[model samples]
Target: MSGQGWERRHAAEYGTTAWSRAVVSCGALVAHHAGYDRRPGAVSEAAAGFRQEWMPVAELLALAACRAGQAQDRPVDDVELPVLLGWADGAHTHLLHTGPLDGHLGPAHWLRLAEDETCRSRARDVVTTESTLAIVESRELTGGRTSTPARALRLGARAAAAQARGVGFPAWADDCAWAADQVERLHLAMQAGAWRPTSAHRAYAREVHRTLVAEPDHPPCPAGAVGPSWIQRVVRIPHVRATVLALAAQPAYAVAAPASDPLGAAVDAVVHVGMEPVSVLAAGLERAWAAQLPDRPVAEWELAHIPGPVREQIRAVEALALRLTVVLLDLWHPHE
Candidate 1:
């Protein structure tokens, strides 16, 4: 591969331990053929993820093995191959387009695996050459990012729970948009005057029911658009703050929201909007985009989203997604 090509390929392969294992497997096979098992640091070095500098050597050795008939190189169509391919395609789609906040936990799991020297050494033994000493010992298989498996698992579980709640950005944005609409409707209901008397309360309840019937039950705005683009539109809406504050503010909320639970469904809906992960993502993107503007100074997370190298871009997107969740959650429910 050309220097640029190798760089791009490495960028794609780096930080994903599965690919590292594949490369190491190639290295191991080459070691078996060349008697590198007898060498002192062979196994440990290969296990450490085979340095970038060693990649060309590994590739050349692998090719030579295949040419010499020592390593059989052929494509086999397994029954499960199609199913696996479909899943991989779907996962990529979900990650980049449909559900960016979900299922990028592979790196974390790999990092854990990298730490287990015993298991790795045992696996190497299982695939060892005739003489038995292995030629692959490597560390930091999943790049330099320090992701705890337990923490990654928690985040993955949360993201999965959020998935059960709804699909990507559109689904979440629709809820918020609908909630804002509810707030507007409630504001309109209270606009005439305060309903102090029992009869006035009844009349107010009737009005709420009528409005509820007139408006669609489901979210109206989101038409399946995903990610920051759709949410940017939502953040740009002029009346969002005013509408949210209509229900969130003290006196207005107290007087406007009905006493009975059914009559106060609008308030409930707004609260539900706050609970969804997608809403949090939207809020985070709002803040990030704001920082991107010339007047607003860019923060570290904000700068990550800027166009750059493939590896940098991938890291940036992941960081932004993670940071967004944190920031939005804090803003949604800031604690003392």
Candidate 2:
């Protein structure tokens, strides 16, 4: 298909009333590092599918671009979906939310790309996959605590957002420190055999344990009673909230791994917008508990070792964060 035709079709696909909201809402949620808003029947079906199905990161960025390039009458004809200007727009919003600007890049820079036809037309001529890739690859990984690609991307997004906002870039060191402290405390508790779940945690763990034993092959149903958001509600006690926030912020836990099917690889790296951090942590906890104390009663699960998955999960989160940063900023400042 011709470029314009392809963009038109892609734009139309996500331009429907329901999908547009899904795109925008998901972008906002991911930008803020918030998880699924899991009130009963709170999220629309379309949004649920978009998040739960793990759509490609590229397509999510594309849909956001389609929204930014959309006009009152129709979507922008020259808007290159692959260019991903829409996500940049969202990032710009995220930057604004972080703090006030001191007139660095200013609103004019974004306004030109968003409103000026010439600027939008210019994007098609200048933006290409290789060109965008070069920009992403050129960014130095700085200020991230982790050494993975996702950490690089997270830092990259922060840097780019800072540059775009024309403000002093803030460090994520505090974020890293806070996450580490929380994890370490949990580790120490586990080591001493003093880390015990409260009544709420145990109750939830029992339910999760039951679910896993009953259907070892069943996938999690995000809309069900034990859905992703259910963990958030159950684990809201004072001690667990920080750990949940730290884990959830990683974003990789929100990314579903590819299935064994041939086509699953395409969507494997897709980030689930509806995924709750606590849900991922709880899932890991549930699996570990189930594996260690399969026949033992729930009362005996406290003796189980600290989950091996925590280290891996933390690593994965950093890696995915970097990948997303690159994707989101690939075609950044296209008009420039």
Candidate 3:
């Protein structure tokens, strides 16, 4: 499918209401894959297979991420496959897409794709052997980390919790939150030297299975309605601010966001606009669009409906929206 098609498909499946959750899940996946595991064999056979075929499938995800205006614009690469899969896993928890290949695709499939003999051989030759320094240098420059199984579990749990909360079914939310808390405890235990890394993995897997078994059979929402109350509570403007503050407290976001970059400025501008009276805010939003995106219009940004320049501006607007969301959350609920 075309990029725009993929965006609409994803939005239709996931809903714009939960965009923040999707972005957070994606970021967490990147962190888990990069920080926790580096060995090629660590990836499951299915995941490896998906990775091998990622060149084609990834276009959909890339388009979706771009349209959503995620934090970074990292293109798909060997290092990114695992991360993207992680994000998809998280997204699945809340907005499960039941398409032609529903049961057939899962983490294992993607893992196998990555580790397929042909793909692995190609990766070794292209990345590990031909341009080893380039790969290493790129990782260094990007500050990428090796994937850790424990971190993956933790991230999975967190993503699940986020989705569950957004879906607003109390039973699912509680279950997901409990699962995440369990993973977090394991993480803490590992940090305190109370458990071995392998042990933590086993524990996490057990907890995940238990949570799945415990989950309510009923859906979180009506076929086409917003999720439970808790989820809505967590996603509202104030709640979003709280979540952002919590995220900022993490070492990653604190370190990654530059103080005075274009991203920061864009965020500031958005927050400033949002803070105005609702009427004023609406007018100012239009004015800002006219001033910054005059030559290129918003209509053009649509996948099929808009012009190329307008589409480009739409992409920029999405980016600005992400920055603004981050900034507003940070300012309204500043973390230590």
Candidate 4:
């Protein structure tokens, strides 16, 4: 499509309406934060990116959160959705509740709100206290300890309204919806210890190696020791390994991975199709980096490559990726 056509498509697909613009706008903000254009082409690119990189992780979180919320009898709200979506945005922008948001809206506030006579009465009528607490806690934790139940509840109300009007739904909303179903799978996996850190690390390493070997041009290391070295490094740094595994296990990571793999994928899917000279050039550069550390972990390779501008871009992407992962994990595994 023409640039104008793409722009119109994006606006229509993600633009605000009376009831739901906030949620859609939040989704757009996520794309924008993740280095997407918030235009039609960019949305398509993000969709592609989401499919590759983030789908699995997002599916995990969505299924887990849904079950948790349902078990607790709490209704999910726009605030929580946006926070999760933002993490999936590949930008990891901090989602704040800038509200005409009544009084103080923090975790404590959410707890109090849940206990409010009116809220309790309402929740009792529609949901169980356990469910209400679960929802409130999920919102609070997802908000990074800054959001209140009142704000979260209000946001939920807004999302409901938006859904009613059919405004700002993501083109990839189906993927997100599927993600919700996947949460139950994740819970089951967790119960079975299928998501253990050791197992996750091994899987991630294998995937990276597989991707590297499959694309011979993108060899892992100059000497082909990149994979082993990456494993060693990750194993050594318990904290980093834990973080990496945790992130790898998120639904957004899997969702965004497909969309952002090779950077150009997102660009092509969202901005324009075919091989643009700029993207081809970027891909070449990425290949060169991969070749440099044929067996190194991507995180290390990213740091080792000293192109100042590229490093900065990587930093930005990492920051967003990290934030999104944190929010998702927090929601499902709050004690952790």
Candidate 5:
């Protein structure tokens, strides 16, 4: 709980290990904006259990958090298991790999500077140059079409890294036109049925759907899934409905209705991060897809359109996402 040590350790390991690598990898994947790492096993077992009928969405989220944060350490403490930090750290990729620092990096590609303390200064130069190289490669891949926020973040992160390395900061461009462009695109997409999740998001939703259908009648946890130190949490239908209403009540998002894609809420969450939060929309869309695993058509999925019980079971994912951002920047964020 001592943030002092946590900060030192996080800075010590930031982008210097498997966890940081995963962050950059995920970030690059997301910064590309439209594609996912759809190769088989792209969704690791670590990312699995998203819709396990027995596990609460909260726990499934916690487990994945444990895995991502655990990259700094891979397992969550008993008391701190619920919050996830992958979102914030994952965003580091935008800073590390976009613009002039881009690269075809992923979790598997391991790159580290010399570890000798005597070589610390030289090591930093290596990191800044490497970060720059990654940016260069990413720009090459994107054909010089990097967005505004993406460019700013990559430069900012690299400069931060250079500062950490005891080097001078590099000057960067001030063109940030892309954030507005993205927000506009989102609105246009919504008009064209973009708020809804595509078919790809269905698999995760199906699991949550089954869990809702079987709950209240059957036991909370299925056979063998239950264990000590576990508390059963059956989400209440009315409470969930109220929370959704509250979100819609004072939202900065355009889609306030339940049937509206969680994309709107996700973009709202990004505004809080102060960077290009729209990138997080990809993850939100996947979650929204899960929440909408209704037994009927989405057009009829207005809050009232959903069954009370299932609606309770299928909750908004932005709450978890925003919470994860906090966990990343606050709890697990090494900067403390």
Candidate 6:
């Protein structure tokens, strides 16, 4: 690799443990075979995520690492071939926008894989679909920023997660984009409005729900949207401060979000928007777009949609969704 400062500092640490060494070796092998030699710390950077993997995936990593070492190969072995192709496909998309982007893999590597008759048939089926999906997703995460370390890291995560389970992002992604944007803007406004000596917290709370409340200047006509009286009953409404975090949690009280639960879509919205850790929210978002698990409970659960620890936070989000729903109802109801 490029002997970047980060690699120099952490490379020795890779030698400190079998697991760490495996990650570095594997990451480096992939980085090397894929032409990332000029890029400093590529292997070590990819290595950081190896901690949470299981043995089967680890075995694949070992194979990938070794394969990269020899012929300095393109792609990886057949154990998790689908995931590897996906990993490369997803990783390459996001890496393109990050800094020192010069030394990374690209379409050429995927093309070589297609040439292999064994993987060829399958590759032909999904390559175009996944690659196009990755491009759109990576762009959203990075946005216009040339240096989003978090978004950049997502490239590897999507790849690894794919390798582990042969899946990409969740299906309800685009549906949640507006809510995520709203929450993010609210988060910033809360931070900036903190200077009010006495009621900064209350002010923050009001600002958090101001749009829903239809406050002066932010008003959007209450008569058109659902009435907010029921939801505003909770006195201690929390800010968008994410106390509980999950990559994505299926909070549906009933399977497929029971018909009576008007806010099931809302719950799905906030959950998929990812209530905590912005990086997770931004990562795999594209995969979610490409995937569509209409009513599959196992698929939903395996997608890692719920962060079980933050039960209260999730309930809070659900309540807020109720409140927000009223706002939308009022906006659209004109006669309400």
Cα-based TM-score, every candidate: 0.25, 0.24, 0.19, 0.19, 0.19, 0.25
lDDT of 3 by residue, 1-336 (tens): 544454454345344322333344443233222222212434455555444443323322322333223322221211132343333333421222222211234445445433344533332232222123223323442355532222212222333322222221221223223333333443354346564333333332333223322322221223444333222211232323333344434553433232432222232233223211122212322322233333432222111112122222223333433443343333333366
How much does each candidate deviate from the true structure in C-alpha RMSD?
A: 21.3, 21.4, 22.7, 21.9, 22.7, 18.7
Model 2, global lDDT: 0.31
Q: Tell me how far candidate 3 lies from the true structure as C-alpha RMSD in angstroms.
A: 22.7
Off by over 4 Å in 2: 1-118, 125-127, 130-184, 193-203, 209-274, 277-336
Q: Please, what are the lDDT tens digits per residue for candidate 4 over residues 50-128? A: 4554333322223222222232333222234433333222133112111121222343433343233442232232222
List model 1 lDDT by residue over 94-206, tens digit each.
22122111123343443343344443333233223211211110012224243322211111112222222222222234445555565455444444434122443344334
Runs in model 5 with CA error above 4 Å? 1-247, 250-256, 260-276, 279-336
Query: What is the TM-score of candidate 6?
Result: 0.25
The lowest-lDDT stretch of 10 consecutive residues in candidate 3 is 299-308
For model 6, where is the 10-residue window of minimal lDDT? Answer: 229-238
Sliding window of 10 residues with minimal summed lDDT for model 1: 130-139
lDDT of 2 by residue, 159-191 (tens): 122222221211222333343343344335434
Over the stretch 1-336, how does candidate 6's per-residue lDDT look in tens digits?
A: 432432332234222322243344344323323323222322464444433322223333432322332222221211133333433233332321223211233345434443334333333233334334334444453463433222222223334323222112222233335565554443443346532222322332233334334312211113433432211211112223231112112232232241332233333345345343222332233233234244533222222321111222334445545555444343233232
Please provide, for model 5 over 1-336, each residue's C-alpha lDDT reduced to its tens digit, 9 standing for 90 to 100: 233343344344342333333344322222222122223334455334322321222222222332434444321211111122222223222222112112233223211111122222322333334344445544543466752222222222232222222212111111112223333454455457654544322332232223323323211233444321011121222222234344445534223332344433333332322222222222322233344444633322221122222122222222333332332222112241
Q: Deviation in angstroms for 291 in model 5?
A: 38
After superposition, the stretches of candidate 1 with alpha carbons farther than 4 Å from their true spots are: 1-112, 115-229, 236-242, 246-253, 258-261, 274-278, 291-336
Q: RMSD in Å for candidate 2, one decimal?
A: 21.4
